[model samples]
Target: MIIDRIDRALDMTSAIVAGIDGGQYADASLCAGWTVRDELNHLVGGMRIFTARLTGTDPGGEHHDDWLGDEPANAFHLAAEADRAAWRRPDALEGVIELGFGAVPAPAAAAIHHTEVLVHGIDLALVTGQEKLVDDQECERLLGEMRAMDFSMFRNPGMFGPETAVADDAPGHRRLLAFLGRAV
Candidate 1:
């Protein structure tokens, strides 16, 4: 079930990445200090690391060096497909994996990947003037994940910025963004 969610999120992420053009890549993304291209690179790098984790291999080093290859969209597609393939392995969903923070069950790892892809997909859509690309179901799922997580887990620096203040009755997506320290 979580793997299904991860696949859905990856589909959305790939679509968003494919829609970006060269000129728009320089636009500021929702991620602080990151341009649209930088966010996409981060997504690619994350996919590589997660793929290695699922396959029981050391991720070794940052892949940012070649992040923006001749064709970024193609690179994203290949990376995402590899990541998906790794997760689809027979024993992939049956083990614990180190997520840098600690070792977590495979399902939890899938959930984390699902959240990252969905959140960053929205970021990519927003910056590319494709707000219509945002999926309400994906937003709702991520909002639920945020609601179910412990607040303390997000308090540390580099985990999230300080939680932003939002109206009590804000929509789930807006609230989720606020909770992640993003100004919506």
Candidate 2:
């Protein structure tokens, strides 16, 4: 079920990336101080890193490397394909992954990966006027899961900020973004 959610998130992000125009890449994203291109590169690099960790292969670059190159959309697609394949492996969720923070169980790592991809995708979509592309049900599900966990550890600079208030009647994606400290 988690992997299925991840696949859906990847597909949604891929669509958002494909819709991005060259001129819009430099626009500011919901992530403070990060442009659209910066966010996209980070997303793609994260995918590669997760895939490498799952398959025991070289990630081929650092987290902040310029992975997008001349074709940002194409780069994202390639990374997504590899990431999906690695996550689909029969034994992928059987062990722990050595993340920069520490060794996290595979299921936890997958949840974090899903959050990264989905949140960043929403960030991009919001900035690019494509908010309609976000999956509200997935956002609601993730928001509930986050609320059930102790997510405060991730609330720091460059990660999630303190939770912001949003109207209860707001859309699911907007509520999730607000909970993650984005001013939605």
Candidate 3:
């Protein structure tokens, strides 16, 4: 089940990365002050950080931000390249990675990793004039997880009011973020 989730997540990331060349703005999302490019970079940069955690290293001072005053793609690209290099080390995934928030087991972190891919995949698609990549099955799994989570991580207050509801079997990424209160 987890493997399937990862497969879908990875596919989403791959498609978004490949489709984007950073030109479209009409279909751009309302990610606060962030442009589509900035949102893509933020999501990719956040991946770089989390990927480093999987490899037992500090990913500098990266953050999981929703807003970008002037976030740069080149900067995020450089950071992502460095993080990729770190993942090549022989003992990278040897120990339990300190993922800033907590020390989660390697296998269990698949869900988190899956979450990153699915959520950011949307960010990339929205920014780059691409279509949504998350399908129904993956969304259901992530939605279930989010509903059970405490939801202070990505749940921005402006987006989800108390009355807003997230369907358990809705689109994967949408339900995932909504469950976290980022249904924007």
Candidate 4:
């Protein structure tokens, strides 16, 4: 089930990138200072980091802030494929991996990446004026995962934003965005 979720997430990310035109890459994303391209970079780099951990290899980099500049589509597909391949390994879904922040069990790591891909996919869609690209089902599933996890570590500066108020009756996606500090 988790692997299927990851596959779906990657497919969504790939489709978003494929649909984006060249000129929109510089638009500001929901992430404070990051552009759409920067968000893509972070997504790809994150997958790279996860792949490294799962494969027990060095990432050969101190940071993952670089962007594709003019080649985002191809770069993203290649990186995404590598990431998916690594995670598809028979043993990749078991045991624990060090995530720089700490050691997390594979399931928790999958959940983290699943949330990242879906949320950032929304960010990319919103910034590009392609909000229809956001998947409602993914958002709902992510909302459930977020609500079930302890939010203690999510309040940090670069992580989740301060909790925003949402109406009790708001839609699942809106509530999820609110919880993540994105005004909805």
lDDT, each prediction: 0.80, 0.92, 0.57, 0.80
Write one digit per residue (lDDT tens) for candidate 2, span 82-132: 999999999988889988888999998998999999999999998998999
Tens digits of per-residue lDDT for model 4, 1-184:
8878888888877888888889988888788888888888888788878888888887655446663545889878887898889878999779998886889999889888888877887778767776676677878888887789887578864588877898988766667788899876
Error of 2 at 161 (Å): 0.5
lDDT tens digits, residues 1-184, model 3? Answer: 6546656666666666666564553245535566656566666666667666766566555675532234344454454455445544565445565565678775555556666657667666655656555465666667677667766544454433332466756556555555544544
Backbone clash pairs for candidate 4 read none
**Model 2 weakest lDDT span, ten residues long:** 151-160
Q: Which stretches of candidate 3 lie over 4 Å from their true place?
A: 1-4, 25-30, 56-95, 127-129, 148-172
lDDT for 26 in candidate 4 is: 81
TM-score of 4: 0.89
TM-score for each prediction? Answer: 0.88, 0.96, 0.60, 0.89
> How many steric overlaps are in each model, in order?
0, 0, 1, 0
Considering summed lDDT, which 10 consecutive residues are worst modelled in model 3? 155-164
Give per-residue CA lDDT, model 1, range 17-69, as digits (tens).
88888898788988888888888888888888888887867655685655667
